[model samples]
Target: MSKIGNDHLTETRDHLINEIDSLSESQLNWKSNLESWSIAQVCHHLVLVEESTIKAIAWGVKAGEPTQSERKKVEQHILDRTKKIIAPKIVEPDTKLFEMQQIKDLLNDSRIKLHSLLSTVEDKSMLAKKSVKHPALGELRLDQWIEQIYLHEQRHIEQIKEIRSLYEELTEAFSSDHIQ
Candidate 1:
C-alpha cells in the first residue's frame, strides 16, 4: 500500500474520532429532520461503506485482471458536498441509535480489518493494476478503492459538522424560549 494512502486513512479516522469525541448520546442521535441523517447514522453509514470497500478491494486484487489504466483525480469530486449522491441500499445506515463509544468501536474494527488486509498484500503494485467498477466513477483500481474510503469519510465529516451546527442552533433557540 502507498504511504500516502495509509496516511490519509489514519488521518481521516483520527479526525472522525475527534469530531464526535465530545458528543452526547442525544446529540449523536439528533437529526435536523426526518429526512436528514443524525451524526450516529452518518458514522454507521461510514462503517458500512468502509467494510464494503474492503471487500471490493480484496476481490479486485484477487480476481481482477491487471490493467495499465492510471488513477483518476477523484478527491475533488468526492469532497464536493454540493452534489448530493444517494447512498446505495447496501451501505445505508439503519435507524439504530449509536452511543459514541459504540461508534468509535465500530470505526476501529473496520479500520483494523482494512489495515490487516493491506498488510497481507505482498505486491503493493498489484493494487494499482487491479480494477473494480464504481457506480459513479467508473473503473477504479484496488488502490484507488482504498483512497475512496478516506475521501468518502472526508465528505461526511463536513456533513457531521453541518449537523453539529444545526444541533447547536436548535439548543440555543430552545434555551432562549425557556428564558422568556
Candidate 2:
C-alpha cells in the first residue's frame, strides 16, 4: 500500500477514536431507533472488519496470486455512501455491549498488526501479486483491500455521527421532560 493510503487509514482511525471518546457509556450504547446500531456496535463491527480483512489479505498473499483487474476503480465504489449493501454475517458485530476502552484497545491492536504487516513489504508491486475476497465486492488485491478497510470505517464514522446526533436529541428530550 502507498504511504498516502496508510496515512488515510491512520487518519480515519484517529477520527473514530475521537468520535467514540466523546461519548459517555450510555450514549455509546444508545440506539436511535429499533433498527439502528449503537455506536458501540459500530465500533465493534469495525474491529471485526479490520481483523478479518487483514487476516484474509495476509493468507491470500501467502497462498494465492492476484488476478488482472482495475482494483483501484473497483475499490473506490466502497467509498460511495449512497450505495448501501449488507455486511456478511461472519463479520457482524456481537449483540453484546462493549466498553469504550475495550473498543479502543481492539482498534489500536488491529492497527498495529496491519501497519506492521504492510510496513514489512519492501516492494509495493507485491501487493498486486496477491488477492482476497470481499463478501460484497468479490475479489480484491491487497491494495484494494486496504482501501476498502478505510472506506468501510468511513461509512461507519458517518453512522457514528448520526448516532451522536440521536443521542443528543434523546438526551435533550429526556432533560426537558424533568424540567417541569
Top-scoring candidate (TM-score): 1
Q: What is the TM-score of each candidate against the true structure?
A: 0.96, 0.91
- Tens digits of per-residue lDDT, candidate 2, 1-180, equal 877898989898888888889788888888877777889988888888898887877787676455665565754577677887777887777877878888889889888888887777777787876776778877777788888888889888998998898789888999999996
TM-score of 2: 0.91
Which stretches of model 2 miss by more than 4 angstroms?
64-66, 72-76
Q: Which candidate is the best by lDDT?
A: 1
Cα error, candidate 2, residue 55 (Å): 1.4
Go through the candidates in order and give the clash count of each. Answer: 0, 0
**Backbone clashes, candidate 1:** 0
User: Which stretch of 10 consecutive residues in model 2 shows the poorest summed lDDT?
Assistant: 63-72
* Model 1 CA lDDT for position 4: 84
Q: Model 1, 1-180: lDDT tens per residue?
A: 888888999999899899999999999999998899999999999999999988988888788469766788889779888898889899989897888888999999999999998888999999988888877678888888898899999999999999999999999999999999
